[model samples]
Target: MASDAVTIQVPGPHGDRDIRVSSPSRVLWPEQGITKLQLAEYMIAVGDAFVLANGHRPVSLQRFSADIDGEAFFSKNPPKGAPDFIRSVPVVYPSGRSHAQLVIDEPAAAVWAVQMNTITFHPWASRAEDTDNPDQFRIDLDPQPETDFRDAVRIAVELRAVMAEAGLTAFIKTSGGRGVHVFAPIEPVHEFLEVRHAVIAAARELERRMPTEVTTSWWKEERGAKVFVDYNQANRDRTMAGAYSARPLALAPVSTPLEWSELSDADPRDFTVLTVPGRLQSVGDPWEHFADDPGDLSTLLQWWERDLGNGLGELPFPPDFPKMPGEPPRVQPSRAKKP
Candidate 1:
């Protein structure tokens, strides 16, 4: 091992592998005074849980050149010089084009990602073996201008109840930003569109129950002062930062999972790359039971059909996505009304 890098042998399902971390002292999180080597070590501490949540899935790396706040870009395809141990799986995009995307199957692969200057991990809701059918249902609660984290927490609590009623178990996590993400483990029998509709149904029901606190509005102009349930994130190829993945914030906050009991007082800033390893040691992974019993979306699909009968239909997909069936005109309401 050279003086500038450290070599670690990480045990994986395949075998133990040596990963070299170059420039380990390079400051990745300047504000927190955390170095690239510290980030690599963090992966080893939480590797199992991180792999359990994100491994075997098509993942996109949010990489940086100098530091977390420096020039950043997303890497979907495996980059040049990728190791033989690293693997990729072919997935179809919204445009119907197929491409090979990277898959993280072990802790060593994640450590290698750290070496690649990846600060955040964005894993798909589906595994590599099955890109069309999602085994996880995800919802992103984004706080609008007038609202804040407290508001997002309240909405998350309500969403937990909603998931319970739908016969699904909900897990909560910070977005590594000013929002919350609630996920449910579901059977992979349903495709991405069905999972998306299930999300819409849950969002609409939450809106019905807490009209003042939440909004299902796709248009930002109409979503004032409410936490927008971003159903579009459930679509294929869209991803949220994986749990425990560090963000590009000045503080290098991580997307930490929490038990429902801790959410009320949970602060996203406290879960930084430097602090998370110790926190994990203290509490273990809140999502340790995440895969123990996967639930089916039958009840939620029923809600979807019920909403369809009530004249509520598909919401807008991301603009980049090809115009979907039953999606309303992509133009804004005011603009469309002008013509």
Candidate 2:
């Protein structure tokens, strides 16, 4: 008993615009029975915060053909026949190939993406105008098997203190999974490599502080049960789910932002598409002032240099990337040939 299509009026800075959602009753989240129309409505409800955190950046859309468990693919470039309001900016991928990537500037644009079957949005750390330099310093706290959300929370708190010592303020969010994401707004003066190094420096400091609880090890076998400080997330062309974006999980969980004071009690499961809008109404957006005061990476860069002087050189770059200048071998430690 659902309509074939529905048009939603989404209000933005330019004014209200109507976006049409096709197959409006198609269930995107089978567990919650969340229809495509409901997904579009969710975007409209969180539009402002969504744009503030993800707009004006190169974003890749994760689209699905059926439900959350169905066929999926990532749309990096603007798909053919995109609407006029949906624009794209050129960016270079790690493969050194330049291509135009989509940018969503308003709520209607996000709704339109929902119509295109997009279930998740991955926004790059750098803004569109300056794709080479990052304005955001991001760290993904990935919990290996045997670890859980509570473990990530502890590491995130300590990571916040580490960032504070480096003169940057940290923000926390659920990764829409068992992990956590910590971000800091930074001046877009340095390129992605330098910013990545700064993240490595911070992660190294955190590892030193909580040796048993945290690890910066790139290989999965080396991580054990510790929370991993994923520094690679800061590299060029790398991205994570943007704040307020709904994930493709069965429960329809969202990558919800949080206040530092409330992080300990925040439960990721309670932040699904069905619950987030009400929570936003009651508590307001935690990241409203995220970009109000942008800090530079000078202190972290100095630490990077200090670590370099101490003989801790470059770690391994992702396998697909052209081998970096000082990066260690991409081979797994256990797989490498004996000397």
Candidate 3:
């Protein structure tokens, strides 16, 4: 009984009516006492502080709280209404430094918005002169493409290892798609460009060690048998729609949540809008305190410099969009299209 018009019992968070979003215009979040129209209104509000500030877009809210792998992340000692999904509220961040403090009456909508877009946080890589969010970077994965869930997991784990060895902490999330995203928490000191290079260094090194398991190409065709570790995605000019909440997922499915350990062993089939809360409660959350985020880019760069050229010749590149000097056109869309 749900449609563009406000309806009920369509199946959501607490109950069918507990969570639901309308098509043309509406969002009913009974768990948080937020209505379809009201939520949409907030979307318009945050646009100023968030979107315009960072050149990012606002993702729509839904009736449900993202089923995050919390057993491992949120400590039980959090305040009474820390985030019990049913008892807590949802927050949205189109873009801007939120106090990160979650007040029950006015929880941070921006953070809640992550479930909707694939967000990247360059946490520590800051320069002494800058004053904006040091954790500024974009996310650019195939928002809607056929992919191997296993490879996505591999990408996250490998990134975690790379970051860990580099002396930085990176958290991973299921992009609510055929991919997973690894986020590094950095302090707000450096601008977008420096952070972007740090990410690039880390990514290139991973491609070197895991040659068959990963690809660092910006082009798709060149990424035939490996997970494309897209370094270009870290470009300051790019942005990732935050993951977890809801997005224009080529259709209408929302980006779901997962626990930390799950990355070692979990499938995309285990999650969906209707059947996630129960799992969330039973297992609690998996990534309660994923990794100790030290927020150091200098250390990461050191690791990168030492290991960059140690991989293969050079990773595969895309087609004639532009021919770099010595590199051959690595991708052949026409050849791949040939039967």
Best by lDDT: 2
Cα lDDT tens digits, model 3, 154-273, are: 666667777777666666556556777676656655555456557767777676778767766666656666676665555322334333233323223234445566667866545533
Residues 1-339, candidate 2, lDDT per residue (tens digit)? Answer: 355887789999999998888889998898899999899999999999999999999999999988899999999887788888889999998888999999989888999999999999999999989999999999999999999999999999999999999989898999999999999999999999999999999999999999999999999999999998888898888889999999999899999999999988988999999999999999999999999889999999999999999999999888878989999889999999999
Error of 1 at 132 (Å): 0.9
Number of backbone-clashing residue pairs for each candidate, in the order shown: 0, 0, 47
Ranking by lDDT: 2, 1, 3
> Once superposed on the true structure, which residue ranges of model 2 sit more than 4 Å away at CA?
1-3
Identify the superior model by lDDT, candidate 1 or candidate 2.
Answer: 2
Return the TM-score for candidate 1, rounded to 2 decimals.
0.96
lDDT by residue (tens digit), candidate 1, 151-230: 99999999999999999999999999999999989889999999999999999999999999899988988898999999
What lDDT is reached at residue 16 by model 3? 27
